[model samples]
Target: MKEIIQINLDNEMDLILAHKRCMKIAEMCGMPSSFQTRFSTAVSEVARCAIAKGKNSLLVLGINIIKSTQKEIVAIITDSEDLKSCNPEAFNYAAKISGHIQYNYFDNQFTTTISQQVLSPGLLTETKIKGFIDYFKYEPPLSPYDEIRKKNIELIALSEKLTESENKYKQLANTIPILICVINERNNVLLVNESLENYLEKPLLTFERKTLTHFIHSADIDNVLEGLKRAKQNRSDYIGETRIKKGTNYIWHLVSITPNKAEDGTFNSWLVYFVDINAQKMIVETLKDNTELKMIQLELESANSQLRFKNKELQQFAYIASHDLQEPLRKIMIMLSRAGADLTEDQKKKFYFDRITLAAGRLSNLITDVLNYSRIENSEQYFEEVDLNKVIEEVLGDLSLIIEEKSAVIKVDQLPKVSGLDIQFRQLFYNLINNALKFNSGNPAVTIGYGDIPNDPNFTGSAEKYDVISVEDNGIGMDSSYSGRIFDMFQRLHERDQYGGNGIGLALCRRIIENHNGLINFSSKPGVGTTFWIYLPKNKRS
Candidate 1:
């Protein structure tokens, strides 16, 4: 069997196309006009049924050899849907007209085939069947409502002319360095030179029949179209510069369009040329200014210096305010302790003295966090070689009281020595381990380990290699949505009654990591657990 044409039986257009293709193939097989009409109608009936009831339906026309001296014109319709479900009248009519019909179902697919014996089997030689295949392969499909016969004749003529012209210019176009294009008067590209194809990083088939605006940048399209329109009106040449796309980038090109005329001096087509000008354009842009750039740099430096001075002043003010507030808070705590000694339990409940003490303690913690956050900026000068194992040991000892209360299990892996402030590292681990025990329901489990650093683009540090340490716990985790602002100052995700903190721990942690030229991040789930990953540079910055 030699398949001649295939059409997707999707809509009315495909049904009409299937009918025309069947008739054309039958006529090509030396069948009379009466037989062609009957065969085509038979195929259309099955095709219409397939389009109505089937999924991904297809119609194929082929020539099947029945015997050495016998041949048949065959039409096959295949679909994902079972043909038995379709109206049986379509198949009966096809069988009545074509005299032979078969329906088969296999591998979850349905196929309905119809065949009719050709009038002259010997006329359809092997060479003639091959010619039929080649013709259908290159012939573009036409709509049923279009002037099908007229358009077919026109296309054949145009194909001959294009062949002749391509042969004449193929060598010259490929040999030239400049990009060239030949377009009809209607702006449809007839041919594009090899240079244009190579420059655009695409094939000639992609550019053929497409207008110049297809390859031009969106911002420069209007100007290029206007130039073409004006050239068409004046019947003259056009020269302009625009950006043409090359792969993913658009490069500036100087375009020249010259009108091509016949012997009667009537314009028929256009000869277009493109010269690259991106490098020249960049040079011109770079040489346009220098004094303004220097002035802008100086202004930026001055502004940055003033910003540094203001930040220092703010830090000092915060330190002084927190120091002064602590003294009064300490006095309030002492007075509350002395008064609690004299008051009965019932009297203390009535006066709310215990709540007052708790509030004062929370305020003290807030002041202390503020003081610590301010102190980190000045502590960077105290950088030294710090043993992380020792830091973890100290933090664990400090948190042992709560760990014992919660029955927390602590797992510690071997840690590396890194260049950072020892006190900050100690505080970092203390807060992390304390929170691990504090936030759990009961019987907390905490694991501390170090591993190879991951390649994270968001790590804003100049480290060749990093020591990545992780502190994970089996405690209540936070929502991932709050991850972005978790390190922001005073960002509290839970109410104070639910979780007690000054809402500055993560912010302080981030600041300390910045001082050590490191990064800190965490991942968490609401009921599962939270893990904090710290990336510390192996070497200290000068």
Candidate 2:
């Protein structure tokens, strides 16, 4: 070992000294110059590991001529027992000589061994083919003392470089913004940079060998475990959101973990970084919630505006139709009445009298329906406590003459006392009954039934409200298509001669229910029957 040469492995610049000596060794051995690139790379890596792991260790590099035809360069290293703890996998390191070298770890230290032999005459001749043929021939062979002197000088230079580099890296690792840490496979912290002190408010020594969960907030334990599992299962980068305990306060941190793999593709540990994204997360949540609330407010405003406009248009239409057209219609009716009286009995025959009377009767019904429609529009239909049963009895009484005229069998159920306007609600029931009776062309048995649907859809104003009334009839039922259009004003399914109506009955029913903040929907089939459902607010009295 005394004749052998040794150089400390430290820093990139100091690598040139050992590299220059390796080239000389290769030349003296008569190996082709091509081996120079490979030999230099191998030597530099071995030197680095020896110094990095060998805190108090020394690297012993030696070249010996086994034979005149073959030469070997071997590196022997001795370091603290800590080297035994280092992983045995080899790592590739780059050398300044434009080549890559592999490191093979061993007990107590690692070694990089290079072997070279003299080339044939033909290969040596080809080395001059590219450039620099004369320098190879004139160079003096290196003695053993020269190798030692050169190695010692290089070692001294590398020692100084190692000190400078260590200081520089320590400063850099301290100043970095992200919290960098190295954890063992068991999630125990092996090394943590100084940046972590800001978060934990403690020194790096306190974190050593401590489980990562110690600093993680209790609420974030499950999420952190999930992130670890994901990283291990996927063998890729993992991201996790968690709250970390800093002093007595908790702050959100986004942690990222990347697996460190050995050369054999086995899991060794993880390299992690934690970024403070608490502010960003809070901002995003606030913005999202605020945006959703604003959208709801805008929608409500738009709906209310539309409702007001519709009400105004309805009022204007009703006012104009009632007051503007009534005077002219009255004059026409009086003139027609006088003209008919002047005719004699023979002239005022049955056909002429019937036709004129029928026309006048239709005009009168139309005027009455118009007046009712106008009243529904102008009236305030907000709901209050009202007796629906009493309202039904009254409506039936008004239609008593017609019921007897048709000999109709009217069935009434015990109706509920719900909240709704007296006038509008009474009108709703009246129109529904009238429709059932008038449309009874096929069936003679009139069945008027009312009941409450449990768990009724509540009114928007009072979430506990349910519609309390319904009218189902087995009379001349309408098809599904006509059922949808039944609530439209002026929409009639039959001619005036067949059904005496201005088509405002169902429309008025719908308007009254709407004013009470209720829903009016129905289901009907062509040949089956029809059911008109009115959903009233559960707290109609509220």
Candidate 3:
């Protein structure tokens, strides 16, 4: 069904327009004069009944396809009011005239449809229907009375809206607790609410000759005026805290000023509100005068900071230990069970024993890593002259099994010695190399080398010339957008089931680098690879 025209049956004038529109549409559909009169009469009768018995009655005329080929002119009348018990005489009359009428009631609303078969369905083509729509939209009324009636309806609607707006403004100004003042664009006060008059202890008429800044304290008057000036120039709202004069004393109040724009996009006036903040001000003053209270607050803040740091360290330790230990423990249990079953085969028993040893070794390494992570978190470890080359070697040895399983390649250049915690550096490379091996789709090729630091604007390190080491990989890379938050705790780009281990590897690397007064960053592209750049300060410190 395609609706061409709709009319709100608000008054007798609308009913006449509905009937005329129905008849004209019927004629346009190639109906004979007799059928057009009958269809129009039936639609008008139903519309009249709906208007009399219902609220917000609407009539729509459209073309509906029947049985895929036949076309008929349909008129639907809907209203918000329930008509279950209303008289059905009009519906019956419409059905007799049009031969098809449907009345439906749902959700306390009713709709009545009246359809008339087109005389020549082929004549009512798409072009013809569009022509009908354009005619009803742009064509002049058949009589002068209709044009006058439409103008009158528009005037009535505008008047009602203006009345409603005035009533709302009055209700809000008189009832709200906050003080309100209306000022013109010239900053001259035009109106003051009763609350404002009471706060000033003066009559409302006295404000007519005063400026908007009259009630503000001298110390805050300039700021309030500047804010209002900017707001007026930009046609935006202004909010600031200022001291307002109440009786004989000045009290702090949050002032908000909003510009009122007219229909032509010009500012006419401004509405200013003052809300009391005296209680909040008193509390702030009391706090400022108490030295013991300030000391207690500082101590409490420091304690909270330490507590949060410890809690985070414990959480990471618990999660990483539990997550990494599961794999090794499962392997050890499976190897023991297999060895128990195949005690007669010496070769199989040796393989099971080797697997158990490897699992135990991995479990021990994980425990040491977790412990080192806690020490690094607490800044308990002292820095020494650390050999990066040896650290890389140890990390490679720790990840030897995964590297061999994945047929991975590791390329290394001469890494410079730096003053840092050895255990932390080992854990950093362990995580980076292990990730390179684990997240690869095929054989992983990782290159660990040092280079001159790139002049990146986003780098925030304080080093003039630092040791810049890069760990590049040929693995499944992530989106570059995740680079910002890639080092956040527990932030994983891939699902755990797809990739193993908890999402704390990169976070730990970042924490260790920060502890050494350095920065760690990465660049990645999906399907290409990722390269992590580490910037370490050259200066030595305790």
Candidate 4:
């Protein structure tokens, strides 16, 4: 078998492209760069000279055998012109590049053949890049007129083949009565028939570096891409829903892809077609809605009932807040009113000063908690990097007196920097640590640490890159059932006097976390320590 590459060296750019194609083939044949340059340069010289003489020169590159065991790269340049008047320098240059040179003259057509021996294991690795080079061969020598006639025969055959291909393609496209397109391996559009262009009410698309995805609805692009991925990954046919624009409306289509591969089993291209399923889809949806109408009505009724119940709960909450606030105010007012003119200094000091001050402080705390809860969503601020470790330090500083009183050992670990409102983070950590200390046993020990999110059943939500901040304490934990409502406002598991919280601390913590685009969760068993896990997105904000 012989290999050949044909080129019409009619222009300098043609010479260049031909040279590149020739060298690529040489490289594919395992020829070194030096040999590649030799073959490409030799062909360039002959091609340019032939073009200069105003002749339709043809160049063919292929494996030409020399001796019994010797095979070399070869370039055969033929033209229907007199070689006697040609520049001798071109042939000389080709001769120097190639080891062998010959001239064949038959019936007024002249040919220049050049061959060079390749080393052992020559062009050991053949490439699939042959399409980049012209592939043609001539076994029997012919005259200039005969060469032209043979070329004419080839041109006729090529024309017929193209016509046949177009006919078959159109037949397939028209028969479908739907949109269809063909794309190359690189997702470049190779063909689109007339029906598709008319259906889209647009000009036929430029058949290069495009796919059906180019015209697909933007919203469905992700789904189409996923389908393409699955098709390639599984190497199977793919069927998916995509929408195509027709005038102002987008019509649904059931897109189907039939992928093709090379002889070497690599992907080649996909023949994609669409079935207009818009009417059918609408029918299916209409049927489904009618069938489920009863269930939907029932669900709506249930939701309305729940909404009313929640409204009642809100009324109860207001009543409770009002009653609680009145008690504290009433205590202060009664204590002050009792300070009569005959009262002793000791009674006046204890009642008017200490009792009034205690009641006022309790009222202030409750108001502050309610205000913070309401402000979570109303206030807006620019996000910034907040140092978790620094926030922890500030919280500990505020609780310094309590820490000393309880002799609590608060261990701080390395914490991550997170993106959020700075003040919110400080309060969030403060609440968790304060609760841990308040609920601790006599010998209080609290551990604050940072960890990757552990795979726990209680954890929910997804943040790809985040930090898990835990405040674990050796405290008297409550029943597991209370964990669900642990963060509810004014929902206390213990008496207010026992825990010393208005039941707003955990709720405030939950609000702050929500503002930071994070989650707060905790776990504990009765008599065991509690661990509140705060998951904050670890964007590099600092």
Which residue runs does candidate 1 get wrong by more than 4 Å?
1-312, 378-382, 452-464, 479-485, 525-528
lDDT of 1 by residue, 81-152 (tens): 876566798888888988888999888889888898987888888899999999787666564443554466
lDDT of 1 at 64: 95
Q: What are the candidates' C-alpha RMSDs?
A: 18.7, 28.1, 21.1, 23.6
Residue pairs in candidate 1 whose N, alpha carbon or C atoms collide under 3 angstroms: none
| Positional deviation of residue 48's Cα in model 1 after best superposition, in angstroms | 11
Per-prediction TM-score to the true structure, in the order listed: 0.46, 0.38, 0.37, 0.38
Q: Give the range where candidate 2 is weakest over 10 consecutive residues by summed lDDT.
A: 124-133
Candidate 3 residues 182-281, lDDT tens each?
Answer: 8886576888888888889876444114666578897677678878989987889999999988878999999999987789988889999999998998
Q: For residues 16-59, what per-residue lDDT tens digits would candidate 4 score against the true structure? A: 76677677667756777898888788877778888888487888
* Model 4: pairs clashing at backbone N, Cα or C within 3 Å: 3-62, 5-61, 29-123, 30-123
**Could you say which candidate leads in lDDT?**
1
TM-score of 1: 0.46
Writing each residue's lDDT as its tens digit, candidate 2 over 424-533 gives 77788888878877888654455555654533333223323564466777777887667557888889998877888888888888777765656777766665666776
Question: What lDDT does candidate 3 reach at residue 401?
Answer: 87
What lDDT is reached at residue 496 by model 3? 54
Instruction: Decide which is better by TM-score, 1 or 4.
Output: 1
lDDT, candidate 2, equals: 0.65
Total clashing residue pairs per candidate? 0, 4, 0, 4
Query: Worst ten-residue run, lDDT, model 1?
Result: 453-462
State how far residue 310 of model 1 sits from its true place (Å): 5.2
TM-score-wise, the better of 1 and 2 is: 1
Q: Cα lDDT for residue 151, model 3?
A: 71
